[model samples]
Target: MATLPPGPVRLYGPQFEKDPGALYAEIRRQHGPVAPVLLEGEVPAWFVCGYREVHQVTTDSQLFARDTRRWNAWSQVPQDWPLAAYVVHNPSVMFTEGTEHRRRAGAISDALDAVDQFELSTQCERIADQLIDEFAGTGEADLMAQYAERIPLRAAVAMCGMPTADMPGMVRDLGLSIDSSGQESLDAYGRVQQAMARLVADKRVAPGPDVPSRLLQHPSGLTDDEIVLDLLVVMAAAHQPTTYWIGNTIRLMLTDVRFATTLSGGRASVGQALNEVLWQDTPTQNFIGRFATRDTRLGGQRIRTGDLLVLGLAAANNDPHVRKDAGGAVGNRAQMSFGHGEHGCPYPAPELAEVIARTSIEVLLDRLPDLMLAVPAESLTWRPSIWMRGLTSLPVRFTAV
Candidate 1:
């Protein structure tokens, strides 16, 4: 169990970015299910692409743990590594194990569970309507920048009871934290931590009806510091991924005639489009993922203790064996988009995201029934991060009314 040779398909570069789906299929064909992969900086890791292999790795938490400190490639990773903030171990629920993880995660679930779904959807509709009004009279809009990217952050900060005044800055900082690298990325992460810390402190002194307030009052006795960290996790989880889900769903609805022609009234179509995006263009395509606890073999690949395994979530969804058995992607909630097993997206989180995304799309279509792509679908470009699958912009036009 020593360092192996670098992978053939470098998971970066323009070629891979331009056509990642093709590269993923090629990797699967050439390297089998659990193939060797090179992360940024030519770091070696395992990419678990097969549906079954991903299932096994996720299900066996002991064998494949969430802790990143156990990763053996740290020696090879550079200090300036942009992704360092993501994998850095903290006392937050993300890096915790066993009882500790359950305690923290349970508090989160309870807090999220207390949210009234009926009210949440109503709130989402308001957020969506407000966003749409900004561009409704313009006759054309870049939905990604103007519409899709704005909704999730606004709704989430409102739900968390943060000041409306802080939102524009929060949106910018959160974007950098997710998309930036090097010192800039670290700076953005620090700013987010500071902001959440202030929120947690304020909530401790004066509580209210919001996620952070609930965490402050929960019986789990989360520390101010712990609440601060977990709040960052929850917000980051809630924001960018949910944003892309909205954007990707809209892109799907506008471009695909199958969806476009069917929307006399598209509550059902909205749900179908949302689910289908989870299968094809998952917001989080590849995850930083679990570390090997000990020596093991997965999908015939020899894995050393402390080796890193990047979960090829989107790839696994398109796995031929599973897709063949399941017939097709439509109506298949079985996809690993939100992930699976113990440390997955944690119950109420996924449900809330669906509420936000569904309402966002449904409202947009209602307000603009004639919504159609402003440019050829081929001209739409995806953002170039291997970890995220999202359009750079989705231009659309409708009658100004």
Candidate 2:
């Protein structure tokens, strides 16, 4: 740790719960774009916060790579580190580099591309209606638990050819994998990997239109093991962020002055609100990140070979350098919410996430024209995790039809 900068700002704790944007601004002011910081276990890392610095790191895959095997601090890390599971190296597309990355990422991209957006939207509508029906008659509901949380995960499972019965288990395990670390994360990952292996086995016998089946039959000729791991990456990437996208966008339309006024006629502004959320309260805040392949200077800090650099994604989106000319992200699409360059959320994935999020809000607005937040916005709280941004619950009320 002595090799890194001194007096590193600890990135964990309650200060982030109130206003993480404020903390990011402070970090940038004191330490510049790339600041010294500590993770869950006082683990030292460089937090990449500047708009251009993030772009520089993510785009230069050769210099800042995803493979955790190159991390030099492994010897100093404790066996019980809470964040250990977040950086575990696996053979999946997430850790693969070079030609192997191209093949695995290509197969995932091709499989996801084959999903007809129109069909995906139609399925989302049905899922939204079904979920709404469950709570509509009650006259009041926690939208986070009742509506926002359900729609995206179901679509993810269905399109991946996973059985409807498996949805409950996948949801439980996936939540643990992101929110918890240590053995809990390891256990949750194991369960999902097993479920994916089963899905791959089924698809091996009978190919279908879902992601798993498509990955199985992809011309790239993926092995069963490869299909299982990559499917894990695909499902994990799609499930959490997309779920929070739907939730956070709904929160914006309900609380913010700009979009709340259009509650009854909401479709026109849904796209704008979605973009605004990406620039403001991005769902995945900190990506546990890249390792330096060789010593380099970034944001005026000396980055050593094998040093860990966490991407402060939400901070990058809020960088004054970028926002000064953005004129507010109402319709601007330049935010790094989906990341950038080769390791960015692959093509069509972000587009498809928009399809799901947009249709979901449109359907809810159409169903409950008089929707209202049940409590003051100040009383609402965010889930406490440095990695992901989401609400504990969004309580709302409306007249039953």
Candidate 3:
């Protein structure tokens, strides 16, 4: 077995957040496939960066598990620790394993599958146009805050059958949940949970042809708490990643001359640009806390039972073994952005998510064909997160329509 280095590499520092791709390249050069790293809260974990290794860890559920209850950090850390918020043991499908994982995941998948993709696409287009109309007269807007973020929330509200009146608050809570300070994050998480719980109750009392309602009807027999957490999972899964996806793809379209030329010349579609982003810069750069079920060897390193493993989705996607020509793999679906195996993304399958993102982008681009970045690309900043890779803002200017 390869010996782990003496000290854990800090993976959540400002430097790492500033340029993760460079950091990942250095790590791969120094540590091979699986590198030992420390999260922001000094949490020790292994980052699986090799494409084949990530696939093995993600698919071989028997060797590595998604259940946080198996995480050694839970026993070692205090309940009120800031990191505890992320590792909160919930009955949601995101944290389950084996049969329970399948049952809970199936409920979500069926609910999402029941949605009309055409209606969802139309709704996204309508929302995009409406949002664009808010800034059409101004000629300048922060697309990240004004458009990319809001469209997904609105679409999620419509799909989950939540009240539109609660959208502003939901948006605030969701943003806080992702980027807020310590205590504020906890408070924001509480509000989000309460809001989702209320939606569960409302859906139960008056079921509609929405995802939450369909989940309630699933034969999994999930409890009320389970249903609430699962609903939050759906909302988070649908809104945040999708939001980043739109922003990233739009950034690519606006800044990369290659993509701009292809899109303008009709040689490549918006779907193709979106796929390239998924392969090169996935929305969720890294995902949490898979625990080893037993003492095991992975990627030439020893993994103890309950040790944490973070799948480096972005790094794995860029792994040279799997991707020989990263720039040429346009429209490729082999990227691990949506993940793989039994615990892969269950809501808003890759195709449907792409449709929503593409529709929104198409509506905005068609309405303002002259859109260009207001600031230099290097001036833009990324959200400092261990789980997601998102721009803090994307400012753009376009001719008033």
Candidate 4:
């Protein structure tokens, strides 16, 4: 067997920080499924690149613990700083393990069952139509800023029974929190927390039939603060990534001839097409962090207790081991942008696929058939973050429909 790459590549500075897809791709090429990489500072983490290893690491509760508390004390931040605190150890429904996690997952699943997918499809299509109507006359617009980001925010807000008016600012504040790179931005963090707290209070008093209110009313062993955090978590996870995917999809359709051809021909399922977008251009490039609770071996190296492991879901999705369905490559296809295992994103299968499909039907395929990039494709800007991998702006234009 080929010897596993050394302990872990200590990753730092702007280049590695800027775009890790290249680094991850190289690692996968060099080291197969499991490679060691350091995140933040001296944090030793296993980077799993292959689909099988990623599934094993993510689903294996005994070997790797998703709870952030088990790792470093400094990783924990104050609850007042919800974003950082969440990044460290907020204990939202997704991170919990064993029976408690299972129970919470079951509750969320059951609650979601009541939501009508058809209604969701209609709502998403309606939102897409409204956005297109407003911007259609403008002749040009930042696809990411004006459309992609707005739809998901509106959907998430409506689902949580929050006012749509507050969505723009809330989404902006949340974006700032995720974009925090230098000294932690207390102001941005405060704005997000206050907005969430207000929503929590409003939802508690008026208790609408939305996901947030239901979670609060049901009180599944989670406190008011915890419930609010949970809601914020959902918003954070749902909005930006989907927005990024939308922009990326448009970019691919406009630039890649083959991808555009497939969409134009109507040979691909929108769901499958969105999956291709996710695989080819994942919104979040970084893997969810997990700490080792017990001594274990990965990448042919012994990982001691308290060691952190980073599972590169994006990289694994592209791994040779995980074969894509025979259908699509760039546009009309399959991918692992949603992640895998118990904590993997539950939204992508239906919630996400429906949105992308409806949006495609309303916008790219129908409303703006000749949509093309306003600037050279290479001129587009990308947001800098170790977590989310997306373009900052995707300017485009199309012949009036």
Top candidate, metric lDDT:
2
- Which whole-number lDDT from 0 to 100 does residue 212 have in model 2? 84
Q: What Cα-based lDDT does every candidate model obtain?
A: 0.85, 0.87, 0.83, 0.68
Q: Which lDDT tens digits does candidate 4 get at residues 235-272? A: 77777777777777667767777666765543264455
State the lDDT of candidate 3 residue by residue for 219-308, as single tens digits: 988887998888777777877788999999999898888777754442256777788888888998998858999999999999999999
Task: List the candidates ranked by lDDT, beginning with the highest.
Answer: 2, 1, 3, 4
Give all TM-scores, in the order shown: 0.94, 0.94, 0.92, 0.83
Q: Show where candidate 1 strays beyond 4 Å.
A: 1-8, 181-188, 325-328
lDDT of 3 at 233: 77
Worst window of 10 by summed lDDT in candidate 2: 1-10
User: Which should have the higher TM-score, number 2 or number 3?
Assistant: 2
RMSD (CA, Å), each prediction: 3.2, 3.0, 3.0, 4.4
What's model 2's TM-score?
0.94
Alpha-carbon error at 292 in model 4, in Å? 1.0
Distance (Å) between predicted and true CA of 44, model 4? 3.0
lDDT of 1 by residue, 110-225 (tens): 99998888888998899889888989999999998888788877777777888888877887888788767767977988898888888778888889999999998899999989
Over 4 Å off in model 3, which ranges? 1-7, 74-81, 182-184, 262-268
